[model samples]
Target: MEDETMSNTSEKIAENVLLLAVARLSMALSLPALGFVAYLLNLNLEQKFQAQENKIVAQKESSDRQANLTTARVETVERVAQSAIDQAGKVNERLISVETKQTQESAASERFQAATLTRLDRLQDSIVGQSNAISALTATLQADQDRNRPPPP
Candidate 1:
């Protein structure tokens, strides 16, 4: 009976050891599975962050392109406006030159007219003096002819 009791005690100790070992194994296995799950979660978060960064970059590039296009358009409009202003200035200069030439021509025409009028007045006075002298000569010739004819009759 004593030998049987010792045997039973040994069997109980062996059974307890087996139960402890099984619990430790289960814990060890579960640790690796938990680590794998954590790795998967980290990968997913990284992918999301990278995708958000890429989207932001694309938006920034699009905004930059739009700003550049607007700047180019504004520059083009400014150039056209400047060209128009230059053309207007040229036209104004041409008009001023034409006016000055017209004024000069008008003055010259007035001077010519004045000179012609003075010459015409001198010619009229000379003609009047010649007509008076011719009349006196004709009267003297008529008197001489009458005296010569009466003495013959």
Candidate 2:
């Protein structure tokens, strides 16, 4: 019985010593392992930040392109509007010129018509005066012939 008790006590001590050695080894390795883990986490964060930066850069480029396109479109629209305004102005000028020319022609035609009417009125008055003079001459000639002839038998 004494031998068995000593043997059991020795075994318990050996087991405790082995557990303590394992715990010490884990504590010794934990610092480097934690540093490695922290390094890996930092690398992952850097990669994520780089990806965000790349996305921002791509978005900026796209925005610049869109702005340039909009500017070009605005310029084109302005040019077209200017062209239309110029054409309208030219058309207005031509219309005014045509109106002025028409007015001049109408005035001349009215003047010609008035002159023709006056000439016709004068011609009619001259013809009426000549007809009266012929009638008076014929009456005087008949009276003279009656005086020259003898009375009726």
Candidate 3:
């Protein structure tokens, strides 16, 4: 009976050592599996970051295109405004020339009127002198005819 008790105690010790070894092996294998899962999560994060960068680049390009279009439109408007200003300047020059010509014509007409008035005054003086001479001659002729007819009494 003492040999039987010793054999049972030895069997229990062997079973406990076997269970401890299995637990240690399982923990060691789980560490490698966890490392693999962390690597896959890092890869997924990198893919998302790259996609966001591409989207930002596309937005910047679109904004640049819009700015270029706006700049071109502003240039066109400025050109049109400058052209209109040039046309206005030309019209102003033409108006000034017309006013100058009109002034010259008016001055010339005034000079002509003054000269005609002076000539008319001289003509009036000559006509008055002629009328006085014709009246004296008529009086002399009447006196001479009356004297020659005096023997008819």
In order, what lDDT does every prediction score?
A: 0.56, 0.59, 0.55
Locate the minimum summed-lDDT window of 10 residues in model 2.
144-153
Q: List the residue pairs that clash in candidate 3.
A: none
lDDT of 2 by residue, 1-153 (tens): 989967976775576567556655655565566556556655765676576556555655665665565556555555776775665555556555655655565566567557655755665565456555645554565466446544544
lDDT of 3 by residue, 25-99 (tens): 545554465456545655664575466556555655655565565556555555776775665555556555655
Give a tens-digit lDDT track for model 1, residues 65-135: 65565556555555776775665555556555655655565565557556645654564465455444544
Candidate of highest TM-score? 2
- What pairs collide in candidate 1? none
TM-score, one value per model: 0.41, 0.44, 0.41
The candidate maximizing lDDT is 2
| Candidate 2 wrongly placed segments (more than 4 Å) | 82-153
TM-score of 3: 0.41
- What count of clashes does model 1 give? 0
